[model samples]
Target: MTVTEQTFWVVIPAAGVGSRMQADCPKQYLELQGKTVLEQTLAHFTHHPRIHGIVVAIAEDDDVWPTLKVNTDKPLYTVNGGAERCHSVLNALNFLKDKTRDSDWVLVHDAARPCLRREDLDKLMITMAQHPQGGILAVPVRDTLKRVDVACIIEDTVDRERLCHALTPQMFHIGMLREALEKAIDEGVLVTDEASAMEHAGYSPLVVEGHGDNIKITRPEDLALADFYLASISDEAASDYDGLMADDG
Candidate 1:
């Protein structure tokens, strides 16, 4: 949205090992609905008319390269990821940076997030188109909050008025993103996300409300929910994964 031209590139960082999900397979490769979660996630942007191309950063040992059975291979570029998620993203940008100009816009997305809705993407783009600052997809925190000490005892109920959960396809001007990431790297500063790096470089991003259904399939219950969501959609829109036939223990 903020990036209007043809220079917009979608960069997906799928290098995380998903240690929190406790899955034997990488979280992105795990099946949701009928397709691999990453495939469903890619389907959203791959079909977007303005998206110039997609760059997927997978771990060197990740089986996603082998198991993912996608056919539309136009703007797809594969690169090896680094040790940390930020490093993986920066590495992807580094490779893409040479192939792209500094002014190109990069939409950094998480491969594990497959529940992203089309309307949300359009909303973000439209919002970004109106702003000159960085952009983030987020929703205001609606639940009560509590702060706990190191021993797990509730320290106090912190104010929830200003809290919001961060989501992706965080979009930034490619050259600016590269410079910010490079600065962090040079300073030996490890950032948790691209927006954080941009913020550290002194840019405030605008947040847009996101849908609650747009869930990340991180746990087994999440997988079940994704399956139902996929079942409701048409077959063509959903991806089929024969690899999951061996999912039963």
Candidate 2:
């Protein structure tokens, strides 16, 4: 089937209290570009023609999500999140079990990662449309690495070759990812990301290269960085539109 013919869903795990940000509320609720971080993240997928629906796993006691004015005509759902991100993702998958088939694709993204580039997103969907094992957007490790001991001493310089910084919108088949997450949780293994769970299931998902501007808001300073990235993206879009107009003229 063509990429547009396939059903695609987005799952956002927004349950964690980002203590690192040291904010009054959850980092996802923090203000950025005149909207909550989560709001900005949701905007990326809400109007995308390829995205069929969205399921957001929010904290059970999250009172802030209700206050946000999100404008979208697509199917947007909210489920009570779990103690861990894996459980939250599984909950979202289970929530959609009745509505989606085993082959339907689901892209799990972070709520605070609001700066995903349009080109990177388009690349992921187009490249992984027919792929048996779906892929994730990642950037190759460019900096020197170090292995440190508990004492803060650098024991060895690690090789950066073939190493990558995993970014989000990790696309996977619904049934496959659900089963993989269930297996990892049952085994008491701490699978950090969806890719890691799939890895434990013996599937080497493809890694589609993406830009590094897709940053997760972890610290207070990240708000500024995301603001900058968002401005740059807007400027680039405006420039492209101007060029198109010039060509038409």
Candidate 3:
């Protein structure tokens, strides 16, 4: 299917306080390349032709959101989020119920992940065309794993062959995701992401291999890493544009 043939929506759960980052504001509201992290994250979808709308779940007392100067032509909605990431996503899904069709695809992304490459997003969309159950962008574990005890002692070495680090932009049908999340919540199941919720509902989500640079900003050091990735992306785009202009000349 072509990009124009399908409508895509995005839900960003930006309610987390990001205690690990130790920032004065939420990590999503932190400054990155002159714009807030949330603004940069929103840019990935806002400019995409295939994306129809976006919903962001923020804290009930989130005063920072109103201060951000986010500019986007696409319709953007904000809802009050819950305490946890799953709750925030579920609330966003609930808000989209009245605005979107049940069959429409929804891509749940991390607000702190600002370095998501456009190619990864394209790859995910292409892969999802063949995946009715939906999928997420992930990278295989390359390092040796370890199972540790509470005492900081290594218990056992885990096999890395079957393991993959899950990333955001987890795609699923709006209705299916909503139902899965709701059921998980009602059953007292812990769902860290959309794929986990789907898995709990007995649905196997596909994993589309993506770049490791698509990292979520969790720690203070992660901000520097994100800045580096964003700079690299900008440089790549500039080089591509210069090449095109030179070819034209």
C-alpha root-mean-square deviation, candidate 2: 3.8
The better-scoring model by lDDT among 2 and 3 is 2
Residue-level lDDT tens digits of model 2 in 1-249: 767678999999999999999889999999998999999999888877679999999999999999988888999999999989999999999999999999999999999999997677777887788799898999999999999999999999999999999999899999999999999999999898999999999999999999999999999999999999998786332233233222223
lDDT of 1 by residue, 1-249 (tens): 233443678889888878778888888878665678899889887766557888898989876577667766557888898888788788888888678887677889888777676666766766675567658888888888999999999999979897888888898878888888888878888988888888888889888888776677777788878776656544433433222212211
What does the lDDT read for residue 11 in candidate 1? 89
RMSD of 1: 7.9
Better of 1 and 3 by TM-score: 3
What lDDT score belongs to each candidate, Candidate 1 first? 0.77, 0.90, 0.88
Sort by lDDT, best first: what order? 2, 3, 1
Which candidate comes out best when scored by TM-score?
2
Residue pairs in clash, model 1:
1-125, 1-129, 2-128, 2-129
> Number of the top candidate by lDDT?
2
